[model samples]
Target: MKKKVLFYLGILIAWFPAFSQTDNSVSAITEAREQLVRKNHEKSYVSHILTGKRYDLKYRGAVNSQFFRDIYPSYGTLVYDGVFFDHIEIQLDIYQEKVVVLLESKNNEQFVTIDNEKVSELTFNNYKFVHIRHDSIMSDGLYQHAFQGKHSDTFIKRTKLKKDKIENTKMIIEFVPLDKYYIKNDWGTFAITNKKSFLKAFQNSEAVVSIVKKNKTKFSKKKIENGLLKAVSLLDPLLIDN
Candidate 1:
């Protein structure tokens, strides 16, 4: 009788740990989802369709355009214009021992560092002229039809959960292409003028997203690269023409 009791007790002990782990996992997912929802509601977190110097010069296919090289003084600069009323600049500071992001705009400037060490800085090229334009009337009509109504897919769901001890997480999210619609509609005009620049600029946008998603310290470069690649693969297919 005692032997049987001991056996059952041992089983219970083992079972409890597994149960606890499962519960913790569920709780983590819930928390992550909540965080993502909050982020989605925040204007800063919403994806913007931007038109910028890079877009204009690149779409014009001026491969030799000095503007292309001039914007990125360093490889770490990421610029997005046209989503908001102005441009959004995100700069990664790699000169320091740690990696960080610098976010800047006309009304606000701040540094957001990962792991509390590296500082990212945001800057606007004072020499450059920033032009802000509303989406073309046709593009605006599509935007309303696709995203503004009850059927809108613009508000995407994103979740990130740490999957390994190396501080890397699995991020799953939906991305609606707010810009692609305009691109597709205007493709003929833009492509004819600047095929090379347009292609390069599009590729650059993909690269920037990869960098943002894979920005981390603990993971190997290969692992980070793979993560970014996987993320882009999943999201790219969901982008619509409008």
Candidate 2:
């Protein structure tokens, strides 16, 4: 594997001259060259290290018709086996609870899944997620990283429940979200659902509430997290520090 990784990277440096030939100005050439090399390095790492079984596009008895967020792939970054890779094409299968990568070859599209254990952190569609085994904060699985504060942090665990409906003659499958929110500080991790629960988690509810309002954080009852995330972030520093 080590030899393969180097072999793939060796092919990338071979095109270093292209960066200089494109621009006569030194600064432009240097900046542009750095960007190109970085992108190519990511490609090399993705192609070499991240490889697995074919990710079938067709639903093979998947709970919902669309367990995936989108049929198309988006570019994102991830940490695998302590190595960080960026600018790679990816898709999230929330129902299956797996990370899939899209690869291209000879004018054809291919998809593959990375090892579950190797994926520790990932970002896609503007959401950051982490999977920790044996976590004291909550269940040892995937959690959408909502906020990372100085003394504390917040994580949201979202799960899609399977639902079936009859649409005409055909049976249709759908996914509905059931999410849990958590606040973790130096002391412990607590599942906070609303303002009352949040206030109860800390010793001084009034002080935390005051800071949260001062920060102008918003939460409400809707198809949302009810504002606990921003509240936790604003109050953590004030509450934990004192």
**Which number leads on TM-score?**
2
Off by more than 4 A, model 1:
1-126, 134-242
How many pairs collide in each candidate, listed in order? 10, 1
Name every residue pair that clashes in candidate 1: 58-197, 58-198, 60-194, 61-194, 100-120, 101-120, 102-120, 102-121, 181-241, 181-242
Residue-level lDDT tens digits of model 2 in 97-134 = 77888766778777898887778898888988898577
Error of 2 at 128 (Å): 0.8
TM-scores of the candidates are: 0.18, 0.68
Tens-place lDDT per residue, model 1, 46-78, is 644322211111113222222221324322333
| lDDT of model 1, residue 125 | 46
Query: Which regions in candidate 2 have their CA more than 4 angstroms from the true location?
Result: 1-48, 58-69, 104-109, 211-224, 240-242
lDDT of each: 0.31, 0.71
